[model samples]
Target: MRFQNLMFLAGASALALSNVANASDLTAAEAVQEARRAAAERTAATEGQEIVVTATRSAQPLADAPATMSVVTGTELRRRPVQDLAEALENEPGIVINGIGMTRRGISIRGMSNEHLLTLIDGRRINDALANMAHADFDLGWVPSVAIERIEVVRGPLSALYGSEALAGVVNVITRRPSERLEASGLGLLGLRDGKGGDTGQLSALIGGSITPSLGVVAWGEYRHRRRTQSPLSPRESELEAREALSGSIIGWWEPAQGHRIEIGQAAIDDDRARDTVTTGARPVYYEYQDHITRAQTHGSYTGSVGWGELQARAYRSVLERVNERDQNQTPTQPTKATDTVFDGRLTVNVFAGNRLTVGGEHRHETLRDSTVNTAGKADVNHNALFVQDEWALRDGVSLTLGSRFDHHPAYGWQTSPRAYLVVEPIEGLKLRGGVGKAFKAPSLKQLSLGYITVAAGGRFIITGNPDLEPETNTAYELGGTYYGRSWNLGATLFQNDLDGLVQTNCVEFCGVRGRERRAYVNVDEARVRGIEVSGQVTPLPALSLSASYTYVEPRDRSKDRELAERPNHSANVKLAWQVADATEFNVRGRYTGKQTIYQADVPVRLDDYNLWSVDVSHDLTRQLTLKLGVDNLFKKRLAESSALYSFAEPGRVFFAGMGANF
Candidate 1:
């Protein structure tokens, strides 16, 4: 790691020297003018009502995609004081952000668990090996909303193009890029939040610029500190936890020639101590946890014309490290640490005859090491896959897509998935589409190794490894239609997914020593989930916009005769935004989540339905400065996005105020 850092620094220095030597070739003023021109062209291309999305592994108009998709642009995200991608996605149709305060959280789409949905950053997966068993939280806290270019959410099965875990869908986060010429930009924010616990402070800053026509770079950092009080419903009673985090990222890009690009980026996050306490008797026992994570990735791509088709190739490598600490004076257990690295590549071609072909492969290897005295162990796993897809234009107004994938895992043998989709554009502004596909997720190391323990019977525990666990599979189908007009747009989708071999742990009373229960992972027979989503945007006035979405889900575990955990049957969101004047705007947003059932430690818990409201106002103070204010959970509703089946809680009402500037 040290050697790599040294080499990167040396390479950057060499490039800087070369740029200085060639300074006479271009002047700063000329570079600025060229950058303005490029920016103008990009702005014009994206100014219409039509939105473009690449969630299908190919760039296509959102209206033409067979599945449901939502596009959230940088402008739309900045309407409020959003901290990360999860916060920005809260209002999107058929998507839910189950945030657990600050450190840990998950995203659920179409009534599926967070692990079922795949998240990608610029087409590269964010490795989270422990997500299935414990708190394997992805560090999205460091990804500032101001640094984002756009975000695309694809609903329904996408395993044919994105690989196994995308049984539910995919969320692709695209970061901003520097212009071809010289330009500088900066943004800063300050905010305070008042909740049940107390008040919290937030600050963030971003600065970026292009050094030359072919070289550009961006750097940003943010810090948030708060002392949060525990809710009344919390089982473990304690004072507010003092939370603080420092996160930052730097990205550098090089475009030496036309149709070629290279990028290197690194991100780091450090969090302060968070303590949870439970009173057993006269003294209170505490569980202290602190997490630190860092990730680095590099990618390069080339595109050009080959024969009658356009061919493109891309390759990338990423490394992630996470260190977790759990300490208690009574229990002298060591901390845990894990590291993961991933490499992937892809090749795609587009023919002039309205046919697109895509082929790709991916390899993932992970290692986990535990240091606790009573639970010291190590495990390694590897996975490889190959996939191909082809889209053919059946006619001037009709298209068909066919694709398949083969995946091999160390624990699970080779598995194949196939998919097919059709699109019919009966008219200029209207289209109908449908698709069917299969997807699967391999078992995690935790599920295969860690033994179950019971604390009810004098802390007696039983440990066992299951080598016979099978992979979970899903067969899904979807049908949707979309209509686009000059100022109005609408989309609707109906989908169903049938699942098999779901991992479940069984515990019977007095099954172990001292009347303790035994637990083991077993494959369940079947489960089914069906849902409908409808969303639209209407512009009644030139300066005002109204958007609304509603989703309904019916998820059940046929084998257990119970509703799936953490899935709400009904949910909806409505938003109204108005440009009151050229320099001022106001917006209001509200969400409703229906009741649901959750299972924890073999017990079922029910959560009541709730409604949340938020409001935001922003004003341009000057040509280079802006001010914004927002209030989340305006009704102060105490609602749980997910059941206590997990050891995390959703936050309450928060107030924010911030400002940004261009220097």
Candidate 2:
């Protein structure tokens, strides 16, 4: 750790303690008690209440939730200039951003792979067909920033309720719902980089209101564009890809009875991206590739009261299409499409005085069409699942939850996932929680189709899919606790995941043949990830607040007996916010990532540690208008200038400005 970083952390801690001690004439414990009382009363007035639903499929306060969870509200979203879901969540505890390509980033939770992370919108699954594709990052930007109400994040496996794909954790983006009163809003933003190229622009708008006594609707649209960035060392070489995207959604709800409601919605995103690069060789080659991608979905949901309990049902169809063309070879364009059709229903009932039981079932049909991989030009799979959960309020401030899910797949037969969680609140403002869960991830359609084959490394290698491959599985354990004071909160958690049956491509034929390598996807890897996360937030003054979090992890490949590649050993984040006046606010944040090890052609190489800092300021110009300005990468960090171990680009200093209006 750097000396300045250590000093910054220590100063923040000291300031928090000193403020509490000097804020009142009473002792430290007494002052905290008084603050708690004040906070409770303030919460009663509708300011400090945080209701989350992703953990148990039911509404509950953050303090009473049965899992390690975090929330990012609409207010926070508006304060930051976040481009997509990955940026919106990169600061949360136990979360990390990983670079995949020149302009693509992935989210990792506690060193887990991105493929195991499940994403949801309004508690419904989004399309994840691109998760296994090369340089694919289409699933992270479905919901526009202007339409999100809140995002609920669970930091551990929830397969017991969500089934496959929830092996690592879940991130649910909840969009704004229809309102009884009419409302409209819009925002415009522009950004410029310090050096050549790398510029950005965005525009978004939304409107919502009641159309009739019992019907309400909401609609929104967004358009964004980013210019390509060029390498500093080589003017003709590109560092970042240029992209243009447009997305929108419309949702409507109607109530025909006192407690019954029906909602229907449609959403779509169109993205066009291009990359340019200069390849150094005996004869220099200049190449460019363009990717056109589209994603669309339509869904309907019903929620109502039944004699025995409450019933909720929903159905949706999602599709993704991608077409790619290269300018150099003048090759024919390649197009691929994936579709998912699903039906799900769940019922919650009061099984006894203190126990609530939930039962649900789901069916999903998936299809993939790719002429290059599937000999028939298409492949399909079906999945069915049943789940049950019981939430028992054992006593005051104590709860226990038990859940299990059973899924049946044609290729894998039947797989079972189960979980048990306990939350104990020995005092009024503290909670201790623990859980043990089992989870699994089924093979992707492309990986499970026996006839699937593709050429790699310029036709030097042949990779084929195996239908006999087994599903990857995991067993996870976690224990955590949180303490909430009048003006501050603190939390810590310890977690471990045991993973088995991991899939990897292995040589199956012509292993020693120089240009005729052949490999098949197989399950023959095991690993484990263990870590600790500590976070805290303190509001020493009504106009100022400080928050910090730190994480340390050890990820090991059991089979190889070595540390996993691209997994950081330590990371941390810190933020300071100040309200200078009634209409003005300022924020400063910093992030630190420790060194990592990566394998290059069988040799382990270590990368250097780095830090990033940013500053943002916002002011309300009027009751209906606001202005925002910020500087990112304040120290001008760049991958090419800092180290040569990595090939991806790290953005340099950027200046951005925006305006928003509500009417």
Candidate 1 lDDT by residue in tens digits, 448-549: 664422222223543344568898899999998877766677778899999999876655344644434565667865889998988877775655777899
For residue 521, model 1's alpha carbon misses the true position, in angstroms, by 2.1
What is each predicted model's overall lDDT from 0 to 1?
0.66, 0.81
Work out the TM-score per prediction.
0.84, 0.91
Error of 2 at 597 (Å): 1.0
- Superposed model 2: Cα runs more than 4 Å off: 1-48, 278-284, 306-308, 330-333, 458-460, 511-515
Query: What's the number of clashes in each of the models?
Result: 1, 1
Candidate 2 lands at a TM-score of 0.91
Best by lDDT: 2
Error of 2 at 631 (Å): 0.8
